[model samples]
Target: MSVQVKDLKVYYRTLRGDVRALDGASFTIADGEIMGLAGESGCGKSTLGRSLIAIDGRMRYVGGSVSLDGAALPLDDQAAMARHRFTAVSLVPQYAMSAMNPTRKIGKLVTDLLRSRGIAPDTVLGEFRRRLELVGLSTDVLARYPIELSGGMKQRVVMVISTLLDPSLLVADEITSALDVSTQKAVAEAVVEFRDRGFVASTIVITHDLSILVQMADSIMIMYAGKPVERASTDAVVSSSRHPYTRLLLSSLPEVGVRYEEHRLSGIAGRPPSLLNPPPGCRFRDRCPLAFAKCAEEPPFVEVAPGHSAACWKA
Candidate 1:
């Protein structure tokens, strides 16, 4: 395993109470694997990604451990984690256009970034130009300001920068959400290209788009509220899901050729439960059609098929 997380619990302090953002998430990502994290809004997907790199002021590391390449990550200590920030783990944040500095030229920004890490920009300048070309950007883009590039261009630039030192693990949080359909496809393909070219050993693509996940991810992990509801290979999760939540989610998606007029599609009726003071037992009980009296007790995330695990009473 390249990445192993055991019982990871991260919470956010609020005036109301501690919001259990990530409660006991455990999983592993193998070398060269692209794991897709799917969940509804505020389901702790972003919290899990951010916790691995940097913990914000609101987030409190309540428990658990994260290991990369057989070494434990000092996620709680900002100073100690500085050594592993960009080189060991990198992130392509949600907003790429706003990620860059408008005042500095792209080359100067890269130079400053390398210098901050005690790396010589001159040594990597040739490689940087090659990478820019690899992403279909001109080498002359190095002289341009962030404001000069379009949204897609800026996103690709951020991708290049994030993987400059070839981080072992890359977290791409909704990187394709803001782009048009064609641009989204291109950017998504570029992400896979990064892995193929050895720019990053493994990646975690966090998004709610199951269709996109089907195109890019090797494995899919579904989260409800603050806990994992299902985990399996992409094929198994899409075609043989045992969890009601996963089944409903997949069914709700409209395919490319599926027209609403031809066949009416229905969305899940009830909304996801609030994480704050969540109800006892399954968080999805209120919305699950197959929920029963046994749902009063929390269901363990157990393997129903080889490499397919779901946390549901019926499963």
Candidate 2:
């Protein structure tokens, strides 16, 4: 496995109390695998992505262990974790377009970032420019400001910068969410290309869009509330969904060749339980269609089929 996360719990420090953003997430990604995390908004998919690389100020690491290539990431210590950021683990965050510094030129910003990581600027710039060209950007992009580039251009630039150090694991949060359909496909393909070319060893793509994951992810993990409810190959999740939540999510997507004039789209009902003082047992009990008395007790994420797992009692 390239990445292993066990019993990971991350909470937000709110004045009301600790918001249980990530109750307990556990999963693995194989070497060179592209794993997609799909869930509704505020379901903690983004929090899981950020927790893997770096947690911001308001986020508090309650407990968990994230290991990349068999070495543990310093989830609680920022200073120690800094040594790993962008080198061993990197994130093309949700807002990659605004990740760059507007005050500094592109090249200057890259140089400053390298210096911060104790890398010699002269040694890396040659490879850096070459990568820029590889991603369809000219070498001169380094001299221009972030505002000068289009949204897609800045996104491409961010992808290059995030992987410049050849990190083993990459967290691409909502990279394609803002782009048009064409640009979305292009960027999604670029991520797979990056994996095939060995720029990053493994990738965790966090998004609510299952369509994007269907295009590139080797496997898909479906999360509900703050934990994973189903995980399997892309084919399994799309065609043979096991968990009720997973089945409900799949039913919500529009199928090709299906006319919507007479057939109305179905939607999952009920609001997601609030993280603050969440109800005990399964967090999804209230909304699951197949929920039972056994669901009142939390179900283990066990394999119901080969290479597949779900946290539902009925699975």
Candidate 3:
């Protein structure tokens, strides 16, 4: 496994209390695998991704371990994690389209970032330019300010820089959330190419857009209230998902040729449980149609079929 997270728990420090955003998340991503973490808003998909690299002051590591290629990550220590940030693990965080410095030209910004990492830009300048062309960006973009570029252009630049060091793992959180359909496809394809070309050893793509994952991910892990409810190969999850939440989520998506005029589109019924004070047992029990008295107890995430696992009694 390129990445292994065991009982990982990360919480948000708020004025009230610690919000259990990432509670007991455990999964593995194999080398070269593009694993998609999908869920509704506030389900901890982004938290899990951010925890693998860096957790800011507001976030706290409650417990658990994250290992990359068998080496444990210092997720609880921000300063200690610095060495692992770009070379060992990297992130293209949410809202990456506007992540660049407004005052610095693209080239200067890259130089400053490399210097901060103790890497001289002259050493990787040639490869950086080549990567720009690989992602359909022009070398002339280096001279332009961030504001001078379009949203898609800015996103491509960020993707290139994040993977410049060929990190062991790349945590991409909602990287395509803001792009147009065509641009989204382009950026998604670029990510797959990064893995195919060996720029990153493994990738964890965190997004609520299942369609995008369907396009690129090798496997899909469905999360609810910070815990993964199901995980399986892309085809299995889309066609033969075992968890109730996974089934509901797929049913909610609009079908390609189905008309809402005849068969109205479906939607999941209830709001997700609050992470601040979530109830015991299955976090999805309140919204699951197939939930029973057995749901009052926590279900273990166990394998049902070969290579497919789910955390529901029905499964």
Put down candidate 1 lDDT per residue, 172-227, tens digits, no spaces: 99998999999989888998999999999989999989888898899999998989
lDDT of each: 0.92, 0.92, 0.93
Per-residue alpha-carbon lDDT of candidate 3 for residues 1-315, written as tens digits (9 for 90 to 100): 789989999999999998999999888899999999999999998889988888899999999998999999998889999999989999997877679999999999999999988998999989999999999999999999999999999999999999999999999999889989999999999999999999999999999999999999999999999999999999999999999899999999998888899998889987999989999998899998998999999999999999999999999
| TM of each candidate vs. truth | 0.98, 0.98, 0.98
Best model per lDDT:
3
Write one digit per residue (lDDT tens) for candidate 2, span 123-198: 9999999989998999999999999999999999999999999999999999999998999998998999999999
Off by over 4 Å in 3: none
Score candidate 3 by TM-score against the native.
Answer: 0.98
